[model samples]
Target: MTTEPFLAPVTTPAERREWILRLLTGTQRVDRIRRLRESIILSLLFLSALISVATTIGIIYTLSIETFHFFQRVSLIDFLTDTQWTPLFTEKHFGIWPLLTATLLVSAIAMLVALPLGLLAAIGLSEYASPRLASIVKPILEILAGVPTVVYGYFALLFVTPLLKRFIPQLEVFNALSAGLVMGIMILPLVASLSEDAMRAVPQSLREGAYALGATKLEVVWRVVVPSSLSGIVAASILAISRAIGETMIVAIAMGQVPRLTLNPLVAMETMTAYIVQVSLGDTPHGSLEYQTIFAVGTALFLITMVLNLLSYRFLQRFREVYE
Candidate 1:
């Protein structure tokens, strides 16, 4: 083997320190740029979220101002206690209960149809249906939601009411039962889709554990899945109620313009939304009592919807399950 000469490495401490300082400076600059970018993105997201809050605030303020004007011309006592709602008549009555009672009746009828069918559909889709079947069926169910409310209104008026009249001869041409039934069908997808999603989110491990305990598939679904997903299921139901309450066209066309205090579902009845549509369709000039009534009714509608959502939130908080 031939011997080779060794070369000594040379580097100044000053150069070494300078290179290290440059590297640290670059890293600090990069970190600062990254932080700035992150801050900008966060700021944009916060503003985007605030937009909805601001819109809601604006609506509440507008309604409050107009409602104050309405209460000036109309007494709160009369509005609450009067049995009639002939606001446009020469002998005007503003008893809100008639409209309120009708609204509740329609909503109750709708829930009766929606809850069982929706819950069952959700359970079947989440537990029983094969993946391919669910994929096909879920979309078809949701397609009902995509249909225009106007179309549903027409169907209720032209088809459903006539069909019901055959069974119950007392049913009117325009009645709450038909509107409510179609409205329930319209809201069915909301309950089913949301509840099914909630049930599906339940861990497979829970089902496995139930099976290990010698439980049947139905038992696992009912005991393990349904109980755990109860919060979401309740939320879905509440959301459907809110939709039913807000729906205008179906009730307007099928339930008629008459506001009656009676509990019977076969008679023509008007909801708050129907009243609003009636006023909007009329030639009621701006700043008139007729115009102000819409805002007042809208305020009430807003309050009712808000209460329902709050109830949903409360129930969700109370029943929500924590899973590892």
Candidate 2:
């Protein structure tokens, strides 16, 4: 049986013209309503995108204004050159390098631990594990992402430092090594999740082609899948490093407040974020140089993270694979 039309063809010419006119009018009304809805949705999305850009501009302005004030009182030369960072002390050394060094040291340690483990985990989950196994393990591993940074700090100071002390007797109670190692663990989930998504996005045909050429699973993954996904992997690594650099509580609690220009991970050190937290916690008078110190450190932190993001975007563009 065939479905009947809502309106049968009219026998009269005048009736047919009337029916055609009504249909066209109804269609036009529907098209107008659809266009109006699309315009509203598009405008809302454009406004939403502007919010982030506006927020970033506001942050840059705030940091720049305060940092300018800080540099007026404290010489830029001293801030860059001096060995010690004793801004709150009676002697008042304004060297920024010590805190920067500590920040880099911790970030370096975190990457060292996170990159290899996270990449390997991503590879295993994407290439080797069964779908069911990958589904179970990925979520379990990502549970680390939800764990609070404060908890990680407590764990570092209470558990990790002591654990390291057993093997390295010289480890300080509040040290960079424990803090960095814990930060690495905190970053692992982010790296692994992003990387696994990237690798999984690769076309299955590429893998099949490799197999037809007698390439083993390992060879296909390393040579084809990994190279195709290199952009995403690098992006994930950059994001993880930026997260490590901006982390405050974990480094503050575990890495101590001493601003020493030393590379020794076994000793106590201070990061830019840790120093900012310390100043914020204290009752430093508003408009004073000590108070302004937070803004200056924040400026530096913002610039570093921004550079990393830019670099990530550059890498993504450079190695992006356009699969047909």
Candidate 3:
């Protein structure tokens, strides 16, 4: 009977070393490819971040240069203290107070309408509504945010203003009240969605603990969930306020372009964004004082938003609750 011969294994140290070297070479190739891929991904991420930083720096530089030119032509004291803001008229007055007061007035009214309603909606969604109901309602509510600002502006001008005029005969055709109310509705989703997300992020263990202490659902939500999520709530409110401040189309179309330094919500007034819109309508000369006014106003709006963001960051840092 013929038997097949068995192949011998590598017995020498040199043969074993060669096999190990081959294995290591393959592993090294795989590792090099993986590292190359990772490096490409990291570089893309860095480039994206660099683009955002560059865009912000460019905007700041442009605004600073134009604002400097503006200050050279106009006095800083008059810009801050002057109550009139007619740069278009033959008698140009550049007092920024009128626009500033109107912007604040409209934004305040918007917050008055939005804050309580948004908070209540968030509470209802997070604590009361079933998951099915929340899923259905949230998308529908966010639809309002998806609606174009120009459409909201027209809705305010055509529908809301007419309705309000019937109830309040003293209301102007173009008034801050309608504009502010519409702006509030426009930003409501931002507040509600953000606040609900924060509330939902509260740990279930915390809720169970509260329940173990015989606390009701309402009690647990208010006493535990809300305090835990206070930073997010404040952040949402500040973001909504910033949105209202920067709103251009709604204030331009419905709030009127009249820069009046009055707190009365029933009267026509102009916000900073609306004034910028009015100036940008191609009627003003490119290098004129009227042209430079938009940049100056934009600088002020940017500063205000930046300050609000800084305040929000500080508030979040101070009150943020971390959970394992």
Candidate 1 TM-score, true structure as reference: 0.86
Compute the lDDT for candidate 2. Answer: 0.92
TM-scores, all candidates, are: 0.86, 0.86, 0.87
TM-score winner, 1 or 3: 3
Q: Any residue pairs clashing in model 2, and if so which?
A: none
Per-residue alpha-carbon lDDT of model 1 for 145-250, expressed as tens digits? 9999999999999999889888999899989999999999999999999899888888899999999999998899889999989888998899889889989999
lDDT of 3 by residue, 1-324 (tens): 564433246569998788789889999999999999999999999999899899989999999999999999999999998889999888999999999999999899889888988999999999999999999999999999999999999999999999999999999999999999999988889889989988887888899999999999889988999998998899889988888888889999999989888999999999999999988886887778988999999999999988887887776565555642
Cα lDDT tens digits for candidate 2, 230-302: 9889999998999999999999999999999999999999999999999989999989989898999899899
**Total clashes for model 3:** 0
Quote the RMSD, in angstroms, for model 3.
3.8
Q: Give the TM-score of candidate 3.
A: 0.87
Model 1 off-target regions past 4 Å?
A: 1-45, 317-321
Comparing candidate 2 with candidate 3, which one achieves the higher TM-score? 3
